[model samples]
Target: MTDLPSRVSINEEGPREGFQIEPGPIPTADKVALVDALSATGLRHIQVASFVSPKLVPGWADAEAVVAGFAPREGVAYTALWFNGAGLDRALAFRDRLSVTGSISLSASEAFSRRNLNRDREGNLAAMRKQTAAHLAAGVPVRRLGIMAAFGCNFSGEVTPAQVFTAIEDGLSIAAEAGVALTRLSLADTMGWANPVAVERLVGAVRARWPALELTLHLHDTRGMAVANALAALRMGVASFDATVGGLGGCPFAAHKGAPGNIASEELAMLCEEMGIETGIDLDALIEAGHRAERIVGHPLPSALLRGGSLRAMRARMAA
Candidate 1:
């Protein structure tokens, strides 16, 4: 309540997150359309595609095609996710279209590293070191540090603040070795095991250790706690977040099938607007994009705002 940020950044991850796990082969055009629609809704950042192995994530086999198709909005920054050098190369081809910066992505839970990334903690660190070098060699800056499974993991159980600290320390070491000064740090609740208190403790501890790193939260709604966890972080002055439009994504590798994905972008924006925190978003337009996402996927998404509608709009109607 006391330390809310004046402006919140909502990075929409629906196109990449949702498209990855859906059972059907969503058309490439539909994927591009969603990115374009989100861009028009005043979202400054949009994750358009994942450049991972098509064999591993067939949904993005047409990643190149989707990147080629979308109309890049001048003001919106489009980003893509790629785990290794090959994926990074694919993204480099669209460097003109996508924001091609890199991140030091690691997992707090060793078990989750093995499950999600198919590597142990040591292997993940080695990979990050190699990946960081690759990004620099390619002339792409590596500044953001991301820790996955920061709260708890379904495979390994409760994750304490200590485990998160170790992960962050490891990431910082990688960046330092590369001579890169990281400006941002992202703590992700990859498995949806985060609660509000855990968010506070972890965020507080991380900030205490590295006060210069700007913090971001990448939360999932696995247990319906993404919004609450986000609120907890916001109250502590953490502003940036990664969310999927209409709750459209789930981790295919986390073994949490049929689980809800990241927090809904429209819902998060509404919450921020209601709290007098500026999100720089058109909530109604974003809600309509959520509906469009449902139509593209041919199924209902988990966003309650998509169904219930925005109260702000209803108030205007009542006043009329």
Candidate 2:
């Protein structure tokens, strides 16, 4: 608890994560609205869309449109997800509006990679090597390493810290070979298999290995422990996280049938603010954004805070 960071950085993933998993098509305008609402909430980072093939992810076929649609808010860094050179090219078109940096992303679970990307661990590495080179060729600085399924995997079961370390090492090797120095690493609990103890152990282990690297957690709340796990990481001084508004995302390919999505952005924001950690986020505004997300998706989201609401307004009323 004493090691809690003075400020926490939350990367909003609602627009991309929520829409992409839904069965129905969401209007581009609604997606843009969520982005616009979230931006005004003092959130500094948002993952706006994924630039994959329409055949693969039809939800993001309108990625370019969404990118073109949003009114850019100053001081907020916008990001998008892409897997190959084509996706990279599409993202490059919006270089002026988006923070188009590259990441050397790997998966700790071999089974997850095979199913998720149709590539085995060795094959995935080879692809990453090519992707890293491509990114550098495009002048996109490849400075971040992301390890997906770092906590555990449904297909593989129980991803140990050693597997995660190996994934990080592979990513680092790719970066080094490309002459790209990585300053940040994001550990993803892609399927919501992380626990509080596991978060602490892995964070401590990673810090021991790469003490200088900034860490970010991408946690899923499928098993209902996302906030506790976040608190554990906070105690270990991890200040950056990837969250979705109203808990509006689930892994479509991770066999997460009816499971909850990523940790709710508003919940994480409320947690940090309640703990006296500055998140630079307007919790009420964020909650509004969550509500907007629910309206767009046309369903109740997984966020309890959204249903219960924050206590800030209640406190204000009591004071009055």
Candidate 3:
């Protein structure tokens, strides 16, 4: 067994990434109910929704209502994704309810950025900086920022680590200029392109550069390397992870061409517990949520939770 860290923080992305790729719209009341259930499970952070234009992502059209309906829990942190200044503006209205506000999209690879954000990597970075600046000027407490597809782009093939580092540097510089202290920043392998070696090396390099920044991991399971890659990150002391219930995820545009969803929250949670890392989440509750999500999508989710039972059950079955 690996010598796991004592604490692991799991950020539930079911409401945001989980619902992003479904064929039709999910009712706002359902979304609220899901968030409420997640809060009851004692998750510290739950992604409620994004504030993108309704034309782009119709699923998150009721972002404001979702936030308004949220009843503040003593320990849970509510978060929302934003695209640009306008999204931040929407998030600002619910300042009291929001614990963390973040902005993210594909990096400026012409092909990926064009389809995802309609901008190049540099242009999107500028927009992110501007929006972050505006939020800072308004005295908004923006905590975490995520850079999507930081490792490799589905449309661009392979992205250089230098490009990823440059983007982070740009964001950090912008944060300094805007005077917003970014609590955490993540490098997301949106298409599941990173291998263990690559994750290790890249994490090493990033840590050497910015040791103080909280590093978050957002890896996909497309190539079946999600667990292995996560192990690499954990070995390097990456404690925070982004996961969806039942491994449900898809970029609204990318799914049409076949981009798989994210790693399963239950799988990761089970792994963490087995490794002696505390995620503060009940594995049974998480698996039950995954099952519920599969039913809602009317399809089998890619999560191992749906295919395999708990680790102990699997072991017992083998013995039987």
Q: How many backbone clashes does candidate 3 have?
A: 2
| Candidate 2 per-residue lDDT over residues 1-320, each given as its tens digit | 68999999999998889889898688999899889999999999999999999998899989999999999999999999999999999999999999999998899999999888899989999999999999999999988999999998889899999999999999999888889899999999998899999999999999999999999999999889999999999999999999999998876544547678999999999999999999999999999999888888888898999988888867988999
- State the C-alpha lDDT per candidate: 0.92, 0.93, 0.76
lDDT of 2 at 128: 94
Give lDDT tens digits, candidate 3, residues 228-263: 889888898899998887877864334454455677
In candidate 1, what are the lDDT values of residues 55-88, reduced to their tens digit?
9899999999999999998889999999888999
lDDT score of residue 281 within candidate 1: 94
Model 2 steric clash pairs: none
**Superior candidate under TM-score, 2 versus 3:** 2
Name model 1 segments beyond 4 Å from true.
251-257
All candidates: TM-score: 0.97, 0.98, 0.88
Off by over 4 Å in 2: 253-256
Residue-pair clashes per candidate: 0, 0, 2
Q: Which ten residues in a row have the lowest lDDT in candidate 2?
A: 250-259
RMSD of each: 1.3, 1.1, 3.0
Q: Where does candidate 3 stray beyond 4 Å?
A: 1-3, 100-111, 251-259, 312-320
**Displacement of the residue 292 alpha carbon in candidate 3, Å:** 1.5
